[model samples]
Target: MDRKSLSLLILIVLLGLCIRLQNFGEIFDSRIYYYGYDPYYHMRLVEAIVLEGYRPSFDYYINYPYGLRIDWLPLFDYILAFPGLFLGFWASEIFAVVFPVIIGVLCIVLVYLISLEVLRNEKFALISAFIFSVCPVTVWKSLLGKADHHIWVVFLLLLSIWLVTKPGLLKLLSGIPMLLMALSWLGAPIYAALLAVSSLFQFNEKEVRIVGISNLIPVLSSIQNLFLGFSFLAIAVFLLVGSFVKRFERRFRYAIVYYLCICSVALLSAYLMPVGWLGFVKSGISYVLGTDIYLPTIREARSFQILGVISSAGYLFFVLAIPALFMLRNGFLKVFFVLSFLISILQLRFVEVLAFPVAILASYTICQILERVDYPVFRKEEEGESKRRGRKEKKKAVEIRKKDHATVIAFLLFLALPCFANSLAPVEMTMDWKEALNWMKENLEAQDYLKAYEKPDYAVLSWWDYGNWILYVAKKAVVCNNFQAGADDAAKFFTAQSEEEAMKIVEKRKVRYVVTVEELTVKPETNKTKFIPIMQIAGYSPEYMKNKEIIDFFNKTMLYKLHVENATNLTHFRLLKNFGTVKIFEVK
Candidate 1:
């Protein structure tokens, strides 16, 4: 609460802002350019909401002729859309680009507050905030132009945790953030599960009630259909009975019973309505655990290696974080850290959540080590004798302590340098891809492509990676996109053994254009090729690319003919544009 502490916290937040904004110039040429696949789709949705005043429940642009129901939580897109209500579309895009940075900076402040609560030391709290500010795991996802729900997920979850730690009225309102978290990300239920389990370590009635009630809102709202309605009513009755009749003498027993009851409701709902809440939760869990059949094809779903973790978290931070898990005094944080770390090892996307507790625990451990050191700067001056000592001696001690603080701060900054440096790079679509999509948009519009069902006359067929870009930038229909909806068909079309087989898929799906990236056809010198992943997703054996016969077969596929051979001699496909990184072909 002191001025110095407040000043330092402000400085730490500013530091995070600077790091997140480091590549802002590259992302903004004439206008804001988003950094990744999902952001583009979200921005597209935001524009829709801004102009239409509500998100269309079903979007015809994605998943081609079948279309796709918009299942994503509207809260994040709504947040971006609100700006457009006052400032129009372009301004909204600008706001969306910078929104993640604003959330990231706020998260830095929350980290400090939560750390202070758990550690009970302002010094350690400040260190934790500083650590999180530059932590690569968080910085990369929360950078400017990376306007995805992930940053909002981190912020709302952190806010919920910090709220739960408060006393009285503030504690009761904790459920609000948990509700917002649920609405922000489909993965929020898993976090609620973790929090419920953590309660067994340190049970708090208010915290449990807040989490339980907040979790129920999402489940209850999923009652539009008959089966879900019945399931919801049944779960509601069971919860009422349990609340009144289930009286346990022990707090631990109460915690266990409530947690199990919540699980039961989820299981029953999932059983009754496979297409509802449980399905979504299972999909999230499957994606995080890499249990989904197609998850390995997605880059963020890949398991993290030890070296990757170290690189993202920093070598020293990882080293301290592991021990700090045990050294941490707060039971909730201890359990949360272990759960997040274990899951993060399986899926890289979970690393951002893991960063929260890692910063706290690592900073806690650092403070412990520094405090235990024999150096005079860390040692408290003798109290009784200090009263008798001259003012000069006391002032000298203060000066030494100041120097000590500076030394430790310098050392902490040194530990954070690697993560800071790693967070500097920004990922965006190549200019070639951008120009190609722009050209596609202009040509499609010129051809009166939007006459039917408010959709383009034809769908573009591309790998799942470029689906969002094609959807958002080209403003066209797509066979497959970031949602992984039409990926199997895409894989089949691209890897089909013959142009005839590929044409069957294209004709079946009404795909008129095929987009190809060189990475899908050619291997990079230093890295593995996307062709292998495409092959894998299409059900090829792991070593298919290694076999000479299979490689020859792959060379004959529609993807190779289009991207590598320029569709030369191909009968039914015509090359439209070759933009080096991106290629477009029209099905004739």
Candidate 2:
């Protein structure tokens, strides 16, 4: 790498480190807890593996009275857990900080490489790298020490594509990283699909044949695992399609034979890695179909900004550079650029990783345009009488071209203002539940059970948000939490609209304290909020009991007193009594 490239790389790495290291103590979501539902439950399995020498099994959580099962990809959490194995808890946390930073740096570097290939300009590539590195949405997930797998998935996707384009022994060696990435996150399959499709448009007959033959071993080896094998087959199909479309009829037969061999191996690998495939297809389908099983619109889609403008416009501007990629002589770069751009739009999480490669192609295109518009000194004729004069003119022209290029780049950067602005905001802001946890730990006796209005992961009185984390961090059983899959009937009762239905959970669970956020307490008198009113509204109904009613019942029916209160400058209320966001109340 040149000095400029080296400097840029170092600068990006430092920037990533700074962002990821800040506020490491905060839990962005309860999804980080081992016992939490969905993503966190899977993370705990990896933690168990590292801390207790336990291999994750479907039955890992079966022994618990709760019968919580540990299932999902173990790779991302394994990365987090590996550090814990060697460095202990503090070191593990540090590893989480460093892991995302390294991924972010790699993302920048990949963008640079891809940009250099397409734009053929180092300056543009550098700019692209800087923008991607500092992007807010990208930085937010990477910095938070949690079960989020998007960053690692994007990094591997970039590495895989880079390997395909560069093509070397080292490039071939990139499969290991790709496999590791697949293990780390479910998004690997999506990326692999995009790469395979793009590869068809990019590679030539000879290159396709070579890649087809080269990938056979890995494909065969992974056949027992259908998903892994499919990735290989997908790549082969892309190559075959690319070659056939290029009128390389002679190579078509060979490609077909190679493809069949890959398919056979993929079949075998499917059997071996059966569990790894769970929820992959279902989740992907649900997401695309907009179903309850997948990330709902509210969760996956970003809300309108303060000005009521959607943030997608910034993404649209970045996408305009795709057609510019075709200006490059290489068909491969054009296809790759289009693929990366399209994949990015498919999911918001893919934006950062996708941006890097897209930027690289954009930079290269800009460089090519500069080269065509103005002749360089080296291109001037030296044998003619006017050669010296022409050279001087060419030099001046080159200087002008460089200045113009810089101005154009500045405009592009300005257009990227939204991306820069988004990066400035904190990604993973959350309420500090440490005080509440500490209060519960210090005061509550071992035998005493705290009832939470919402399922807390730990033993403290449960608020809806803290349920999963509480369970994981406190190492104590919880009544009800966010795990809809595991909670079954109990979850239904907690979320029910009827007060009698909700009371059934409270009475049956022997919940001593009802914890809820202040904002969630009000009962709606309109049709909009027909859902269960956790707290009564003053003007709604005579039968609608407010916070005071719950408190009165707790005081009269049992020996009850407020044991903790957590107030903050923020809007959320944290009251230990049944009247507010309760932490704990003693039943005397």
Candidate 3:
């Protein structure tokens, strides 16, 4: 790398890490990572695997007693295992801050290398990496202690794309990263599917082959028919072909060989492996299908404005990338970009995967703008210095070019300001609510809530939104978590007309505690309650979601008065503790 490029690369990575650490100033400062759904979910899992040695069976933490088995990918969690053991109970907090930032920082380097391979221009690649490094949502999602697996998924995707950009034998060995990518996240399948399909474009290539995946670790998971496992089995068949035919590359269908192999494995898996394989594929796709229209989700269900973390300028390039791919058609990266972009619009979480391509395309657009002004940074090597002298004869054009230099700089800053601005959003907002959870942990007795015969069991009845946090932070059983039925129950609990009705449901679930954020409460004078929109329930549907359903559930039921003075006599509930805006009420 050139001296300037290498220096800028290091600068971008350092800046990315610093921006992500913007929320954190010191280690063990008590507020290291965001304390929300995915973060807490992973934290609880890491704590279980490392500290408790809690191997989940039919009874898992997420869905609670009703038990919806969340398909948890263990790759990132395994990375935290050893360190978590040393930290003991504090494992999640420490690992949360460390892993994401480490992976995110590495992404800066990976993104730069991937861009360099595609663009073959260090200048453009540096800009691409800069855009990615500073992307507001990217920064927030990839921050230290955030503890989401999507970053690993993104890193694997970029590596796979980078492999696609490689020459010959390297590309053939891409199944290695592809295998890792598929095992890492839900979206990895999309990458595999796209890669397989892209190979169709070059089916006629004379030296194509679908080699077997080298399984370094056997007996990975219980489900032998896992999609990731299927990926390997597909590779095994590919390798077996090499023994029979000397070279599968000589065939016209060589490029599509991987596609056929994966398809065959998938079909075989569906018929013989188990119905879960088909169900898994269906469930994964159902998430992004806008038509599915589930009640609440983290991403697409909400309006596009929900993803305000990404600035309008950044989003403009994100839109530009569709055409950008079409412009650079007939490549593996283009296929992946086009597919990822298509899915991204359906969900905001999926947008992080687009950071590489979005940044790459944005960099190209910036370069194009600079090229128009004949800016030195973007200008191709000139044959003569007199070219500027000759061009100077056109005084008007020279003045226009000079005037545009400021425009280029302005535009660069304009595009960058939002990402940095977004990075500044209060990180405290994530874990601030954990105060309620902490209070419960210190107060609640030690035992599982379902075991009523042993001790008076306790369960926290809160909205499904904070269930993960309550369980993770307080080590208490939550009435509802990510499960849809649990969410429905919580919704009913809050909206019920009478305390007796709300308590009936709470008692049925053995919920000793009912938690509510002060923001969700109404102003006693106004008789109005605000909708604390459920974070994950933010859906991509265009169907107008009436906030009134939840807001009036508080107002119409007079539940808002619970936080106000002398609102109503405690018929069936008693105040336990109030942690700032977070309030806990005991079911009387």
Candidate 4:
């Protein structure tokens, strides 16, 4: 990379860093735990993995007496080992908030490199890098305390694509990133699908064979286990195969046949395993298409509607991107991006993966237009034509501030203004959530309240959305959580017609305490609410809850206590403690 490009990269990354800091005010508050609820779930797991040496499948919190095995990939928590071990809890907290942002900034580099390699134009690469740096959703998810596995997912994906595009020995490194993706996220299979499709045209028999063998490693292990062992083996497989691809290709048809045979065998083994790999496949379908009743209510599961404003996060990007997809000459990128864009249409969260290609598309087209408009950055009169050619030949620095510099500055302001306005406010943590959680942590019985002879435990009954946070902060078991397990019954319990109906669920689950939040509630007098989106998540209709016949029934349940005084006894529930907006009740 030339010095001019390097300088632009640094400046763009700095801009990304600044954009992510838009919500800095919300994260530092002592009263708030984390910006989002899901982060707490991951953070709690990291805490167990770090301080207690706890491993997956040994968790006793979320699922209560049955014990819980988190479905999350383990590498992310393991990645937290560094800051957690050395700097202590505070330092680990800092890492959770900062690490994703740093990764996010560096992603601009890979996107630029990929655009540069594929388009063969530095202008296109630089513009795409700049666009990526300021993307709203990317910035939103990369902020402090928003530490989900997503940023890592994006980086590993982009890195894999970058490696695949590299010439010679560097191309062998592609599998390493793909392996890392398998270690980190459930979406790793997208790589395999893309390659299979891409290879239809650019079919390198030896490369396909290497990938085929690498896939075999997963088949040998038990299904449902992270493919860590196989991931390591894949690196060596790719290295060896890359060295021999040309040599093995003399009988090209035979080599293709062999590769296909290996892939078929590996796939058959994966399906025949005792544990089902098919469940993951089914779950993906259920999640994206909402074929199962569970997914339609999930905000992330919804499609990105072009006119939905916030859901689309600026349609102009897509308008530019769609055109760029057709304009791209790279066979692999074109097919992969089309697949990614289609997936994003099925579920909006896939935007994380789609951003890389879309940015390249949008930026490349804009850069090409600027180039054609006589907006050259290095003027011959200023830099000397001989020096410019010499710099290009040596791959050295060239003056880039002559003409298009003004256009670059103006274009940046245009993109920045909309991104700034559309940026999501930092998830503000409220005092109510903090207060209730703190109270429970201090007050929950250390000795098992139930003497059931088994692992004596207690479970909190709350809405599923808050249950994960309850488990994380209160350090107590909960009947349901964000994972959507048993959510229908949670909704049923809250919206039950009578106390007897509700107590049946509470008794069945061994629930000792009940918690409620007032954040989404309407004024208490009417017991009516406009905030029913979450209620919809649990498979209950807003009208069903708010019907005139059931308005009294809804008020009696008191799912959210808007004020401390609002936590009062009604039927079987006895008021235990009140933390203003968050209140606790005991089943009597």
Which model scores highest in lDDT?
Answer: 1
**Residue 420, candidate 3: alpha-carbon lDDT:** 68
Consecutive 10-residue window with the lowest summed lDDT within model 1: 223-232
> Against the unseen true structure, what C-alpha lDDT does each candidate score?
0.74, 0.48, 0.59, 0.64
The residue-level lDDT of candidate 3 at 26 comes to 31
RMSD of 1: 4.9
Task: Give the Å shift of residue 556 in candidate 1.
Answer: 2.5
The sequence of per-residue lDDT tens digits that candidate 4 reaches over residues 108-130 is: 88888888787666767888888
How many steric clashes does model 1 contain? 0
Give the total clashing residue pairs for model 2.
31
Candidate 4's C-alpha runs over 4 A off are 199-284, 304-314, 377-404, 426-428, 446-456, 520-569, 576-580
Each candidate's clash count: 0, 31, 12, 0
- Between candidates 1 and 3, the one scoring higher on lDDT is 1
Candidate 3 lDDT, tens digit per residue, 436-503? 66668788665553221222345678777677777766777776774444665665666566767766
Predicted candidate 2 versus true structure: per-residue lDDT over 269-296, tens digit per residue: 5434546554345455334334452222
TM-score of 4: 0.79
Q: Estimate TM-scores for all models.
A: 0.85, 0.67, 0.78, 0.79
